[model samples]
Target: MIRLVCSIVAIVLCVWKVFNWAWWKPRRLERYFRKQGIRGPPYRLIHGNVAENGAASLEAKAKPMNGFTHSIVPRVLPFLHQTVQKYGNLSIFWVGGNPRVDIMNPDLVRDVLLNKFGYFTKMKPNPVVKLFVTGLVSYNGGKWSKHRKIINPAFHHEKLKLMMPAFYTSCGELISRWNKLALEGSFELDIAPELQSLTEDVISRTLFGRNYQVGRQIFELQTEQQDLLFQSSQFAYIPGQETTATLLLWTIVLLSMHQEWQEHAREEVLRAFEKNQPDFDGLSHLKLMSMILYEVLRLYPPFPLLTRFTSKKAKLGEITFPQGVQVGLPILLIHHDRDLWGEDVGEFNPTRFSGGISKATKNKVSYFPFGWGPQICIGLQFALIEVKIALTMILQRFYFKLSPTYVHAPHAVLTLQPQHGAPIVFCKR
Candidate 1:
């Protein structure tokens, strides 16, 4: 009996090894990259580059990062930016033994996102992520189209205009609280949770037409999901599929960091209102809110990375990708890539988007904060207005700065977030 058990164990180990070598080798797609004359660090077996990527992420999170030098994309994918630096525009990397080709050329991106989106769909997702976030952000093909159509009206200009009052109310409450704090002398508040509460309030009131109680629950659940996902350390998950996890990572991180921006935005809202005395309906008509929406989406996109999968044989630009290969859009990487956005690519310059997104990049496929093509974010306009109304009202009264206890460590746990907490000081203006 002991010998029988030992034999079974031996057989299982051998079979697993064979499968890893023959089917799941990280370099299975090496030939595809080689055909395109792209070079990359040699792929590691089974683990590929994921272990090193994880280590590098830990290192980045251990210290404060200079905005220009702090690379959120490379931290998530590791060795990818270095590969691009060495291999030029097109390159390949692995995500846990899965081959994902990274294409930075705007023309190639345009071809894939615009001309041939049907050929690529969302990456094969983890079963766990498919549970929580089952919204349009994760859908593809016909299902994607249907969801997009249904969600479109939520973001219509008229609908957004109606939602403007909710934004003002939430922001007003925050400012009023700060006013009381200022009167009491030293009031140290953590801005991370505060802004989160603010955004939650907006999403709740506008999305569900109630207070932020439900949105707050969703946000708290998402925080738990973030922790669970990190323990799993798996990517290529479905949208809103992670149950308690979230898909909007980058926006959270940036809002946590730019405390001063919050203050400036509040001032802008007040100034606009004072100059025009726009009521809720009138405030919705304010152009400054529109500009702020564009700027924030550009600077701090919620989902920084977009992943797609190829089924059957498909041609993307000069390279032909055989079925079963995953492609990463690296939206944030493209947004900040110096080649696409001049030397100030890494700089937080909202002026670049002053003329609107289409004009921002000359119709290039680089600046898709809510994604593009048929697979574009269904809630793009909804998310933006939710943010806009929230910011406008908050800015009406308070000044923000980095909290004294704030630690500058941003990490990706589903979405980018402050590893410690978003410690921000709110001053009543």
Candidate 2:
């Protein structure tokens, strides 16, 4: 009789747990956030807003934007854009059974990223994702700090200076290929794969200390890793190759569209190098190029969304975040926010960053292309130098414009990527 009673109690507990997870806990979180004036779309049972997100995204991606516009929050993250529009910055929305409160306000974003008290934590990555995206990104506690310490040396300024020759060689190879392709003065080519190859070679040389071409037997394994990294949409961070490649590709496309900025950047690059090979110190003189790159980063940020989850109940300013709820820092939305960036927010105006990021952001925690605070991407410095090398070399040798066949479909699969390839016509300088 006692065994029967215990078995019945166990069954009852299992049923209650399932019920709580599916229905009760979500509703409780919704009510909690709502009581504090954070309101979003009403949660609907188990699939809460997942279906809605999918349907909205499908509708948004059905066609390209009406024209060339950088206000891509509407295209890349249509569902979140709509939620923010209707529900305001601290809006609470549901992701399946999980409740996510998106922090669009810069102040809240700062607190979450700083994560001073360990209240907020990275959403544990899907196991498959952790295979390659391990190390600093995968860990949160002491392990994260330990890995960060270990990896810090690789991107130190001295290390990057040593890699300058590698940078020039990879870029020179690109110039040679484009020289052959544009023999007739102009060549229409999809520069995406070409740029990817350049960044890939740079990464190979940096990480493995040799050109990938020299050892096909080993580098073939690297190719397989590349395929896996891109194939997952739940990717928290884009690898070095994709991140830098996308930056260069978008810079080319944006510069092509806004030729005046292109002229300014080239003039600056020419003055910096002036027929001499680009060197480490010479990069500092390319101020206009820096402004253009920053502006491009603002417009087409590689990581569109910065997502985190609360590990425990915590207070931010006057508001409290409950445990089990996710916190989203929408970089795409915040970068393009009218309040933060002003009326001409959608336009490609590199001049906005003429006074550098501090002046452009007015010392706010608003501009973080590689994220901010402790967990910011470690490879940012390396990525910047790599991009500068490619841009400087390209500007010295060729002029490029968007190919007529190029489509302006910027969507986020893993990172924000061109749905169709970035086809640009390059003319010999």
Candidate 3:
């Protein structure tokens, strides 16, 4: 029996290697690009460019680096820079044996996102992705359309009014905790964890309409699943990975790093909530909360990478890609691009969203925090309102700051999140 098991294991390993070497080598795609006069680094065996790209990513996270050395190009995939730098702005690269063409020009991006969308489709939803945000963020075509229709009413201005009280309840909890801490003389505490807990609680009560304890438990479990998924970094894994925990971890990391923005956002939230008690009917109409939602989506989209697949041949400028390619649209890179948003793009400026999304994108097809086209995020409205309501209430009652132990390193297990758990201290203002 043992011998049979060994034989099966050996056979599986052999078959896996054979498939990777024969069919999945990056060279298979590289040669095609070379034939078409496009240039990229010669593909190495089965690992392809992953090693170099991983190394670059590790280096970038270790210290501050400029875009030229550690950026969307090289850190995302090895030869990413080489491909674009050598072949000009239009180039192709591979990730784990799949071909992906990067179209940096805004015009081509617009065409793919809007004009020629029929040819390209949202990336096949990773099975893991389906678990957490099972609502609309991962759906496509008919199902996505149906869910969107069902969910539309939830995000409407009037519906948000129905959610404000839930937000206030969650926020009040955070405030009470902070006030107790402040009474003990705590100040300059990390706010990320507190905010995350507050948001989770708010989402629980508002969406599930369940008792706060039940909702909080559900959120806590989901958060644990998120964290498990992140630590495993298994692109394909069981659906049970702790998603909620991981999301909370990343949220804390991101919010803590930008301390100044934390203060600014805190001030805004306080102003909004102090004027009202977060009453369900009245506070939903608050414009400041809406602006906060837009800003948070911009600075830290939940899914940093927007992936899609091609159903047929697609053309972006002079380059044409065959079907079955996985296209990754990195929101982090696009959102921070200097050309897209001017030199101040890296800075967190909520004012940019003052004129609303249309004016913010300058009528471009960019800045899709939820996504784009017919398959935009379904839970987007739900998520945004939850964040706004919770933040507004917390700010009215407490102050938060990054803990001294905080570190800045954002990566992807499934969504864009911090490599380390966000550790924050909280105090009442």
Clashes of each: 14, 0, 19
**What tens-digit string does per-residue lDDT give for candidate 1 at 259-313?**
5554455566666675332454545555544654555455445566667788767
For model 3, residues 327-427, the per-residue Cα lDDT tens digits are 65656556656687887665656678878888888887668766676555434555555555555655565555567765555555555555554556665
Model 2 lDDT, residue 133, Cα: 58
The better candidate by lDDT, 1 or 3, is 1
TM-score of each: 0.78, 0.92, 0.73
Candidate ranking under lDDT, highest first, comes to: 2, 1, 3
Comparing 1 and 2 by TM-score, which wins? Answer: 2
- Better model by lDDT, 1 or 2? 2
Q: Which ranges in model 2 have alpha carbons more than 4 Å from their true place?
A: 1-11, 213-238
**How much RMSD separates candidate 1 from the native structure?**
6.4
- Which lDDT tens digits does candidate 2 get at residues 282-379? 88677888889999999999889888887898999889987777888989999999999999999999889989899999988898888899888888
Please state the error at residue 169 of candidate 1 in Å.
4.6
